[model samples]
Target: MNLLFKKKDTTMKTIFLLLLILIALNIQLTNAQPTSKYHAKLVALDNVYEGDVDLNLYGQNPSLVKMEWTEISPDSTKKTIHRVQYDMEAVLSFIIDKDTFYVKNLVDDEEKVRPYYLVRKVYGNDIVALYQYTSKEGVKRIYIGLPRRDPYYVQHPFFTDGTNMYTAFVYFKDCDALYQKMKAEQDGYWFKKGATDEQCVSIWKRIIDEYMNCKK
Candidate 1:
């Protein structure tokens, strides 16, 4: 009986040690996580459009895409103008096969990022689609921010192949978490559907300006 009692005591001690460790880890995560200054994140889309396709025929998404910056700033100022510049390119192909598309979504093959962000262009609150797609199949398979019910795998996915191909690079933080943020904050932006190259550069200029002015 004494032996059994000692064994039980040992097990209890081990369990207690584990619980303490878990609590410490949880506390670390809470403290270490990055915080944005603004309670209200400004959700915006800056478009760099590729070629358009007819839905009557199925194919991959186009090559040579564009990117825009959306911010959730701490300050509340309407119509603040800032400039950003995106001047990086890489050697890789963004292609689609029939209904499926493969989007690296990076400037080049060599660059690396942690894929810390997600962009969901919504027709409305209920409607969300990723950047690439097949017109006939619609956005049924290829979307980043779809609300999945039981199978949580459907939400905030990267490098997922389906009706559309979604891609991500290295981000400063976790990819899925960043994606969840963009999906949740659903705010409208100055979306330029098919702006000219010059217009697009101008938009980047605004981003650079804002990014510099904003506190890191």
Candidate 2:
């Protein structure tokens, strides 16, 4: 009986060892995939918001824009990982965090923060459009009240600059579905369920401006 029990224990250990090895291999394989170049971020921004955002019209927050991360494929391939958010009902205000910066060279006036979300547009029938800033790992995305600027007003626009808020003949319009698919793929490709974060934000600004005028 003792000899038979010992043999069973040895078999179980062997099976456990094999399972571990297989798991490791699967993880490696998952991390080895590559991604295609996605220009959807530019398309959405240009098509929807146009040049209505930013002080200089590049559509970026004119304040502190800390470098964030870019997404990587499971196989360590670089991914675009374009992101979008919708806060049709969220507030829009400035971020005023005191003591956000520590002392530098014994300066008397400590550094202050004044983060804010400039207006941006959403470009998909799936995800709602937002004027919020791109989110990083730990930083907070603060919103304040500004209902007049909400894109949800597409049905009854109260403002316009060009071919923007016109009812072609007579109808309310919103973002298209094709743009939704493109945006989805871009957002999901780099957002691994449990992987990298802010470190992946590409430092290059041109990357987000390529398709600034593409159709949905």
Candidate 3:
């Protein structure tokens, strides 16, 4: 009877220890992952964009592209002006692939008529994409603040594949978190020179992996 009692106590202790270890691991995992709000945002965004047309096709053929910048006057007013020229025919040809495109809020001709293909251009190692938002003053603003080098290196807060509507929206939504991860993993600095397609894609794949893992 004494031996059986001792064995029962030992088994109970072992089970208790295992439960404690499992609890600790759950806490660690919860702390390591992103906040509940971010996860909720991801879920909401994924659902919103799931069935939309894949804009990747537009980026595949970027024949005509243009760059733009923001100009703030002394009066504290801001305006986005075209920094480079564009070919209307080239822009039109690209858009002709799809019947039509629309923006949620058509504030101006720029955002209304302009297709993603014309506004987001990829150079050797850099991507310049138009970012538009409604300002506090109730005006639509646009700008392309691209880095001279591989924007990914500096954790540029824009998508490298902005021409892809879904991907770009996801990048814009999670840019800060993604940038922090990239900066921490890549020696905490941005690349000083242009990056090749292979290089950029490899880095992006890692970023995507990290994101998906966290989601899991």
Candidate 4:
């Protein structure tokens, strides 16, 4: 009888331990999955939509796919969900996870024109800095948008070859004193050999901030 009781106790303990292990594994699996749905607000040429949306922005055929939810009953108990594919050309902007993206026609070095989403980094009185992730290059490309001039790519201080550096400074020429100051401080600003992307972006933002302050 003593031996039987010991076996039963051990079996119960083993079952409890197994249950804990199963629960831990389930939690790990749930946390490992990427987010598939998000609440988003999109602005179009004539309409605005706000609801749960699924983004497929990195695939071969990138798109802004939105899932809209509507109340179907007076009590707001019944809801209907529908899928919509937004016309990329007609979309002006969108907000997701508190980040705003603007639709812009981006032209590449090869003169290829395509619509891409740009997130504003710095908006000053005279110029605005915008950036977008280039999945093919696995890096972010920054651009300067000026009045009456098409937005052009600017070299990432640490990532690129600095081919556009001259053009970028030229655009800043309107702010003559600030441009000269930035030109003189160019080496100190972005010449770090091994700075990270975030560091480079910070430096660029500081430069723009200085420009804005000087203009005022």
Winning candidate number (TM-score): 4
Report backbone clashes per prediction: 23, 20, 1, 0
| Local accuracy of candidate 4 as per-residue lDDT tens digits, 1-216 | 999999999999999999999999997676442334567787888988887765534322244455576657788888776666787667766688777766666655565555544444444443556455454346666555555554555433312445445555665687787688656756545435455546656766766776677677
Best by lDDT: 4
Give candidate 3's TM-score: 0.23
TM-score of each: 0.21, 0.18, 0.23, 0.51
- 104-178, model 2: which lDDT tens digit per residue? 111011222222223333222212222223233433221111122222222112111223212221121222432
**Which residue runs of candidate 3 sit more than 4 Å off their true CA positions?**
1-180, 185-192
Clashes of 3: 1
Backbone clash pairs for candidate 3 read: 153-190
Ranking according to TM-score, highest score first: 4, 3, 1, 2
Residue 37 accuracy (lDDT) in model 2: 25
Q: Rank the candidates by lDDT, best first.
A: 4, 3, 1, 2
Candidate 4 positional error at 185, Å? 6.2
**Candidate 2 ranges beyond 4 A from true positions:** 35-216
lDDT tens digits by residue: candidate 3, 93-210 = 1222332221211123222322232122222112333333333365533433233311122123233322322333244234567556444434321222344434544454454455
Candidate 1 error regions (>4 Å):
1-31, 41-125, 131-143, 147-216
Local error of candidate 2 at 107, Å? 29
